[model samples]
Target: MLNWSAKRPVIAAVAAILALSACGSGDDSGATGKKDSDGVITVKLGVVGPKTGPASLYYKYMDQNFETFSDDFEEKYKVRFEIIGEDDQASPEETARAVSRLINEEAVHAILGPPLSGNALQVADVIQKSQIPWLLAGPNADEAINYDIQPNWAFQTNFTNQQIMEILGTRLFADNNKVGIVYSADGFGQSNLDHLKSWAKENGKKLTAEESLQPGSSDANAIIKRFKSAGVDSVFMGITQGADTATVTRAIEQAGYEPKTIMTTGTILTNYKTIAEPSQWENIQIVDPRNFLEGGDKEILDAVQEATGEAPAIPTNNISTYAMLDIYAQAVAEVGDANDREAVRKAMEDIETVHIGSLTIEKPFTTTDHKLYDDDPANWLTYGFDEKFNLKLLGTAEECLEKGC
Candidate 1:
């Protein structure tokens, strides 16, 4: 491991830390008429996310799987991929723009993601209006479905906020205690916070204190102080990037508030070490649902390392992006034609299994079953960090799933 401490100058902030968080694709020129011969094939797809931001670096990790999926699908199925286009600089406005470009201009039938939940809300609205069935691999905004703005055409791999609470709250019970919450004032953060709160309350836990930080305040000390004042025993934190884990950890220290644990839905475990001294890491916990690939999962891992020429830190959201691309490719192949938009959607919806890396979509998406992992929390795994930033397996979600707050 590179010694960041010795090499660490007294810089104001980590260059990586300054990178934005919370949140991309290509064009096939022959896409218009490149239909499969025996049957219609060749799929056009739109991938949207913030590529240029604090979290822009994540594009690198996600893009690798996208490329690999594209190539492998094309080779194995003899199906051509009109896969095209990427929008990384995030904005629901930009996401809508990307969707318009994909549906109207690029003519893609299905869309992979607009990574952030809030961004997904915007893009999902546009696609649903177009009557395009989109299977989402990112964003867990419960309101998207509940608000009535989202159509049956829009779906995700997991449950609503109530399900998250049903699963995590049971394991994360706080007897007679109200839950603590913190998030960015941004729409995405608030969306996640809202769901967690609703679920927390249904389980008898009140939202004790709610606080927000100004956008771009990577250091969470100030916010932690406010949550401390609120006397929260546990935290429902919402942040864009996994790197923010360190900042939240530091903020908790600043506030002198260390609860029994911290839970972040949709948050990755890659950056848990950044928030404080290494020894304090055990105090932090993550409800991540996958086995991390530090140096494991030789095929994809080695390929990713080779693609980068070295091992770049894998973003917390990296697996979803990888899995999304793979799932898309599998759907196209299973349908035997990438040309049919609804067919592609149907195939994607029918993703009942996957054979990749350490993770598996044991019970993947289906027309009837949109939920990815089984409602069984055992399918989800918890994770943490070792002395370095390597991912360490904590336990299975089954071990912690519960009903009350």
Candidate 2:
């Protein structure tokens, strides 16, 4: 083994090289497509996310969908796709390096990934400067982009914090009920809390209690006890992981505090069912752009199961990936050249309507609006869980707000 003194020079030299390379000029074409004599265009795409980490579950089934759906996409659009994946481990530092390598070395036409809001924030400016099409399938912070900037290169397939809070706020604040929140002390949770506060201010309401939980915390009894003391009638969770949400759920059951409503985002649908008892999930509800219960996305879900011989571990994210790829393929075809990053970006913004599987999006994109789903309560769906933790459709957000589901 090398001595510490001997290793110092080598480590410093490698760091210098990486720093210089990151600042160096790369291919100006920006992952241009190449056409072969057979009249086929090949586009290279870079995928960034945690392949192995505490958060790896968020990336599950993404790669499989890429493989299972490629042939069909190629047949329809006459364009072939080539994917280059980089494992960021869901760390901001690793995410920065992975994004740099993808943009500077991999030369990808577009990039998707770094599901967490914090990781996404780490590379936002560099990606925007690179002028690459950024397909945001995760990370819902409204601050992800400076909205004042025109001709934005990034587009969001995930709902923003503001959009989700708009729907949840109406239900949680109905009948002037006292509300309490328990959020993870992380970027995702912080953003959700900030939006919730804004929603309350705009609507002239007040939250009775607020608490923060660290990731992987094993207990939330104190948080639950505080909510009880505050006489909170509704409980809203802005936690990042399903397991953490389970901790809160278990605490609520143990303390025998029955809030009028228990609500959270789709993150609860990740692993809460497996970690918490069926009874703990009794009155829990969540709002999402897509419905997972009763197979609202049955057509694509069934196809993926048949192709892979198993169901997606997280059906909502898998279907989001499917929709994102479809939109990317459509843009490439519309531009007639994936090599022209600017053209492809513009094409993506102009897509008015897109239908895939059982999901149909109207005006999915526009020059000024990049979010796949807007803040219209009508566009959001509400869901509850059954005794077996299966998704049960509640109603549209508008209907659910006016009348209990």
Per-residue lDDT tens digits of candidate 1, residues 299-320?
4555555544445345434555
lDDT of the candidates, in the order given: 0.57, 0.77
Weakest lDDT window of 10 consecutive positions for candidate 1: 11-20
Error of 2 at 238 (Å): 1.1
Task: Show model 1 residue runs off by greater than 4 Å.
Answer: 1-28, 32-41, 80-83, 133-135, 145-151, 158-163, 175-178, 265-276, 293-302, 310-316, 358-363, 366-369, 400-405
| Candidate with best TM-score | 2
Model 1's TM-score against the true structure: 0.78
Question: What tens digits encode model 2's per-residue C-alpha lDDT throughout 101-199?
Answer: 888877777887777787898898889889998878778888787666677888877788999998899899898899998998988899989999999
TM-score of each: 0.78, 0.89
Q: State the weakest 10-residue window (summed lDDT) of model 2.
A: 1-10
